[model samples]
Target: MIRAELPPYEGDTAHLRKMFSYFPSGVVALLANVGGTPKGMVASSFTVGVSMEPPLVSCAIRRQSSTWPELKGAHRIGISVFGEDQGEMARQISSKSIASRFEKIPLRHADSSALFIAQAPVWFECSFADELPAGDHTIALLEVHRGGADPELPPLVFYGSTFRQLQVSSADG
Candidate 1:
């Protein structure tokens, strides 16, 4: 067996982030309307089906996120799981310019003010349930009120700091 020596762990942020990027994850947009204005942010650290009985999902949000503070007080939040072709939409929503995030982007609004991205693969209307402090971020639990999925649209994947598409395999292995 060939074994190679690796460097000792130093807890470096950059190194840790680079290593973490190797794992692929689905991206989602968290959107809401606060005070007649739509607020949205992209998150790759999103998990669905956290609880079956209560219908819950979770997302880890950075502590420094400006958009979170505004959306936190909203009546409802929209979780839009990006479709494979919606990578550019994710980039635009996560851009630094808050004012232009939704510019030229098609959206759907609920009576509860939950704003969803049009044609997204999955959509969830959630209300903030609880939040706990995690190192450098907050772990938020959201109670799903309503949700829908489109099986035809493949999900967008984030891997190695880039957007990726899934390739379906043959039925016979």
Candidate 2:
């Protein structure tokens, strides 16, 4: 079989964005305190458990993200794993409008360091450890401090261009 060569199409960044957005992903919110004020951004590229012995987790943050620098070296960072109900909150955090991100959203301080929100089904408070440059983003390695589970809620999946939830199965079947 012969493979066909594809022609290049030209457009703005939106074209590239729409192309990559096709991959479905889970939404997560990274929260940290900067100068006594809470700063957070929604992300979907968070990676999994790094070490089992020391209890560690990892995430990647773009070097160009405005909030990444402030979040780096934080004593504690809150990782809020969003449930399907938090789609609006995720969108708000992902938006460029910084002034209205936390508006109407309820957040609580946990362990005097990490900010925990009620909307998330699962979350973890991690202590800052080390980070190294990985391409255009920095791979942040964090030591787990505290975490909890909420299996009652379904995860919010980011697919194509929007957020979606898993369909529940009927018991009768």
Candidate 3:
């Protein structure tokens, strides 16, 4: 087999985004009820179980995200890991028009006032842990106070710039 030489590196964000999309990542909806109003955003960069003792999870958001400000100030935030079947819902929530984010989705508000999407497989009740500057984005670290998952639901995966469901088979083949 022969290998071709690659182009020289250029600091282009579009190029970076395209390269990053090659890897599959889980998607999550970050939510909160501010003064009885449901607010949320879909994030594909979410990561879980950062620390066992402190119980930390994290997600990265653009520096200019308008939703991040409202979420960080809330007493508690809800993180709903999208189920494999919730790709369309994730896209709907991620839209720029916040007005229609939860237009037809069922919701759940925790006792702590954290809002979550009802059909998601996993949900986390978290408090803001910290935020660090990371290039053009801010990395948000959250401390998980409580969480739950539905064992039957598989996670939604973002791969090659599209939503996909993970499918694994037994070793019998």
Candidate 4:
């Protein structure tokens, strides 16, 4: 094995950050009912289609997050793939104040284990499968029991510390 010493450079943090920010990702709000109370947080690193045979999706969350403890107890998880209109809700859930989160959003009970919100472009009712710690955050792998999306709705995207709405190109235009 061979290793080379890298040269020191200024603004390395900004350069590294810009590199990661170039990769756009969809935002998801994960919710779980713990002791009949709903706990949720917005995450930008959620990815779909981990496995096709059994069907799986995963989300990465920091180990020290306050919401992760309560959410882990849920038998299943509610995954809301946000539409463009839900960006406000995403910010609310991402806020440090937990007491007021989800106070304004309408949630419905789904799978007897999670809460589903209306108007989400895509929704998933998934059973908690397992979690693996990777550096500062844990990767939670979920088995997708059921999921669906509205074709006409657009997705909520996050990039470079800002939220973006997905624009579809229509052939008729």
Per TM-score, the best of the predicted structures is 1
TM-score of decoy 3: 0.92
Score every model by TM-score: 0.93, 0.82, 0.92, 0.88
Q: Which residue pairs overlap in candidate 4's backbone? A: none
Q: Rank the candidates by lDDT, best first.
A: 1, 3, 4, 2
Candidate 4 residue lDDT tens string, 30-140? 888888788998989998889987898999999999888778778888999888888888998889988899788888777577877778889999888889999888999
TM-score of 4: 0.88
Best by lDDT: 1
Model 3 clashing residue pairs (backbone): none
Local distance difference test values of all predictions, in order: 0.93, 0.82, 0.90, 0.85
> Which regions of candidate 3 fall more than 4 Å away from where they truly are?
1-8
lDDT of 3 by residue, 81-132 (tens): 9999898899999999889889998888889968888878899999999999
Supply every candidate's count of residue pairs whose N, Cα or C atoms clash at under 3 angstroms: 0, 0, 0, 0
Task: Give the winner by TM-score: 1 or 2.
Answer: 1
- Native-to-model Cα distance after best TM-score fit, residue 150 in candidate 3, in Å: 1.0
Model 1 clash tally, residue pairs: 0
Q: Is candidate 2 or candidate 3 better by lDDT?
A: 3
Candidate 1 runs further than 4 Å off: 1-8
